[model samples]
Target: MSRSKFFLVVLICSFVWAFVPGYLFQSLTSISWVCWVFSKSVTAQQLGSGMKGLGLGAFTLDWTAVSSFLFSPLISPLFATVNVFVGYVLFIYVVMPTAYWGMNLYNAKTFPIFSSHLFASNGSPYKIADIVNQQFRLDTEAYDKLGRINLSIFFAISYGFNFATIAATITHVGFFYGKEIYHRFRASQQEEPDVHTKLMRKYEDIPAWWFYSVTALSMIVSLILCTVLKDQVQLPWWGFLFACAMAFTFTLPVSIISATTNQTPGLNVITEYVMGLIMPGYPIANVCFKVYGYISMSQAISFLADFKLGHYMKIPPKSMFIVQFVGTVVAGTVNLIVGWWLLGSVENICQDQLLPPNSPWTCPNDRVFFDASVIWGLVGPNRIFGSNGNYIALNWFFLFGAAGPVIVYILHRIFPTHKWILLINIPVLTGATALMPPATTVNFNSWLLYGIIFNFFVFRYRKKWWQRYNYILSAGLDAGAAFMGVLLYFTLTMENRTINWWGTGGEHCPLASCPTAKGVDLGPDSVCPVF
Candidate 1:
C-alpha cells in the first residue's frame, strides 16, 4: 500500500477496534446478541470478565511504557528495562515475604496474601457507610462495634515508603538542581542547550498565551464538574481549586524527574494525605480530589513530553497539538465506556464469594483504589497512623525513605570511584513494594527472570544478536499473548467453554494467595466461598 493509504488504513482500524468493543458494545449490550451469549452461563460470565480484565491490564502497561519507549530511541532500551528488573526483585522477592512471614505484622497469613480490600478485625469487609453518623463523621459507637481497619504489613510498608520517596524525589531534585532553579527563579533567560533542543530551533514556538487560555478553560470546567457532582463525589468547589493548585505546583518538579530518570513520583499518596487532613471523614470526596489533582498533573506532563518529542522530530506544533487533543478525547471516552461496561457486567468484581473460582476479574487495582479511599478518605491517616492506632510503627518508613538517599549521597561522595552507589535509588526500592496488592509474586518473578535473561545474560554474551532481535522478539511475544487471549475469550469463553484443567485458573499457589477460612481467627469476616 502507498504510505498515505497505509496510514489511513491504520487510523480507521484503530478507531473501529477502540469504538466497537468500547462504545458500541457498551451502549448496545441489551440489544446485542453477543452480550446475551456471553452472559448465558456462569462460566461464560467469568470468562468474559477474565478477558476484559486481561485486556485492561495489558493496555494499562502502556501508560508507563511510551515514556520508556521514547527513552530507548534516545538511549539504550536494555538499560531502562534492567532498572525495572532490579526493582521487581527487591520488592517481590525481598521486601514482601520478609514483611509478611518474618514479621507476622497485621497477622498477615490470616488474610488474603495480596489484596487491597480492607477487612474488619472480625475478618469481614469493612463497610465505611455503616459506621458514619448523620454528619458524615466517624461514629465512635459504630466504629467500635464494626472494628478497626486491618492492613497487611506489606501495605503499611508501601504507604510509609511512598511518603518517604516523595520527599526523597523532591530533595534529590532540589539538591542537584538548586543552581538552575535559582537561575530560573531570578528570571534569567539562560537556556540549557542540548542537541535535541538545538535541532528544533528552526520551528516557530507555540505561544504561551494559548496554553494559559486552555488551562484556564479547563479549570473552569473542572470547578463546574466538581460542584455539580458534589452529591456523588463529595468534593467541594474549594477542594477542587486546592487540587488544581497542587497539580500545578508539583507538575514541574515531577516532570523533570520523569524526564531525566524514567521514574515519576506519584502524587496519589501525597494528595490523599493532604486531602485526608483537610477534608477528613469524606472518603469519596478525598478520592475524587486526589484523582483530579494527581491525574490532571500527570496528563499535563504527558502532553508536555509529547510536545518535546514532536519538537525533536520536527513535527509541526499545531499538528501535534491537534492529534494529541483528538487522541486524548477518543481514548478517554473509550476507556470510560469500556470500564463502565465491565464493572456493570462483571459479577463480584472485587468481592470473592459471588465470583467463580479463580475468576480473573478479581479487580486488584480497583481494590487498591477503593482501599485508599477508605484509608486516606474515610478513616483519616491520623486515626490509622496516629500514636493510638494499630500499626503506628509503620510511620517510621517515611523517615527511612527520606534518610536513605541522603546516606547514599554521602556514600557516593566518600567512594567517588564507585558508580554502583548511584544505583541505590530509595524511590525505586519503594516502588518495587508498591505493586504487591495489585500484582502477584508470580508476575514479579517472571518479569525479573525474563529481564535478566534478555538484558543481562543475552546482552552480555551476545551483544550483536541481542541488538538485532531482542526488541522485535519481545514485541512479537507480547502481541501474540494479547492476540491469543482475545481469540480465546471470543471463540471459547464467550460460548461458555473452557479448558477444565489444573492450571486454567492461572494460580500456582492458591492457598497462599488469599485467605481460606471463614471467620476472625482465619482472617477477616469475608470467607473464601470457593474454599
Candidate 2:
C-alpha cells in the first residue's frame, strides 16, 4: 500500500482501539493483572497497582496515557524519554518505595506509596477547610491548633525536584549555550544570520512599536483588573507587575530549552513560591499571580514558535503578527466556549467520590492544581516549607540542580571526544518525572515503550519508513482518539447511560492507599495494617 493508504488504515485502527480501552474494557486503562491475581492481599496490590501503588508489571492500553501531553513519545526524542524512564524507575520504584517501607521518611508509612493527596500524621485525609477562615484567608488560630500540613512522600519529594528543575534550566543553558549567546550579544563582530533569516529580508519587517503597543495596552488592562476589581481578583496591582517581571526574567532560558529539546520547565513552582511568601493567606491572589507568571511566558514561547514557522515559510512579518493576534483571540474564545459546555453538560464532573462507579469524569490534573493552591496559597509556605514545616531540607535541591551541570561540563572536558557525555542533559534528566502526581506509572510506562520502539529502533533501522510515517502516525492517532473521546462523552456519559461489570471500575487496589504504619487509623472504624 502507498504511505497515504497506510495512514488511513492506522487512523481507522486508532479509532477502533480507543473504544476497547476508553469504553468497552475500561480496566485496560489500569491493567494491574498482578493485583487481580492476589485479590485479597493488600500488600500484593500495594506492590502491583499501577494507579495507586508501585506499578510492578503494570501498564495501560490507552493511547491517551502515552501521548496526550507534552511527553508524547511521538515528539519527545528517545534519549529524553529514556532519561524520564530512568527517573521514574529510581524515584518511584526504588527511592519512594524504600522510604515508605524502610526508612519511613516524613511518616511515609502513614500514607499511600504514591498519591497527590495530602494527609495527616495518622494516615487520615487532611481537611483543608479547617485552616481557612470565612474570608478565605488562613485562620492562624485554626492552623496553630491543626499543626503543620503534611503531604504524601511522593508529593513532598516532587516539590523538591520542581525547585531543582527551575535551577537546572538556568545553569544548564549557561553551561551549554552561554558562550554562543554572549558572542551574539557583542556588537563588534557578528555571525551572519541563517538563510531563513536572510530570506525574510525581501518583505518589510514589523515595526518595533507594534509589539510595544500591544504590551502596553495589555499591562494597562491587567492593572485595571487588579486594582479596580480588587475584591474579586484579590491581586494587588504591584503583585501583577511583579508577576510580569518574573515571566520576563525566565522566558529567555525556559524558551531556549523548550525550542531545542521540547522540554519546558514550568514557572508555576517558583511563581507560587515567591508569591506565597510575598502575600500569604490569599489563595485567589496566589493563583492569579501564578497564572500571570507561568501562562504568560509559556504563551509567549508559543507565539515565538509561530513567528519562526512564518519566517521559515517565507511569510511577511507584518502578516504573521496580524494572523497570530487574531488567531489567538479566536482560539481562546473557542476554548472558553468548549470549557463551559463541558462543565455544564457533565454532572459531578470533577468530584470523583460523588461520581458513580466507572465514571471517567475524574479531574486528576485539576486535583493537583487545587492541592497546590492549598499548599502555597491558603496555608502558605510558612507552614509547608519554612521553619514551621516538616520538610525544610527540600530547599537543598536547588543547590543540587545548580551544581549538576558543572559536573557534566567537567566530564565533557575530561573526555572531549566522548559524544555520549554531552548527551547527559542534566536539565532534562532532573525534570524527567515532572508529570507525576497527575500522571500515573502506566502513563510513563506506555509512553516510554513507544518512544523506544519508534525513536530508537525504527529511527535507527528503518530510516526511510520512519521519516515518511512517524509524524503522520502521530497525527492520525491523536485525531482519531480525540474524536472518539468527545463522541463517547456526549453520546453515552452525558445522558447517564450506564454499564456495570467487574472490569469497568477503577484499579481494584483499595489497600494500595492504606498506610502500613502500625496503629495508624484511617477512620473511627478502620486502622492500618501492622505489617
Top candidate, metric TM-score: 2
Cα lDDT over the full model 1: 0.61
Q: Quantify all predictions' global Cα lDDT against the true fold.
A: 0.61, 0.83
Provide the clashing-pair count of each candidate structure: 6, 0
**lDDT accuracy of residue 443 in candidate 1:** 39
Write one digit per residue (lDDT tens) for candidate 2, span 273-314: 999998888999999999999999999998998888898889
Question: Clashing residue pairs, candidate 1?
Answer: 123-524, 123-525, 124-524, 124-525, 124-526, 283-377
Tens digits of per-residue lDDT for model 1 on 105-209? 677655554556677765556777788877665676787777788875556666776777677767666655667888887765566767877777766777788
Colliding pairs, model 2: none
TM-score to native of every candidate shown: 0.76, 0.94
Work out how many backbone clashes candidate 1 has: 6
Clash count in backbone of candidate 2: 0
Query: How high a TM-score does candidate 2 get?
Result: 0.94
Model 1, position 509: C-alpha lDDT score: 23
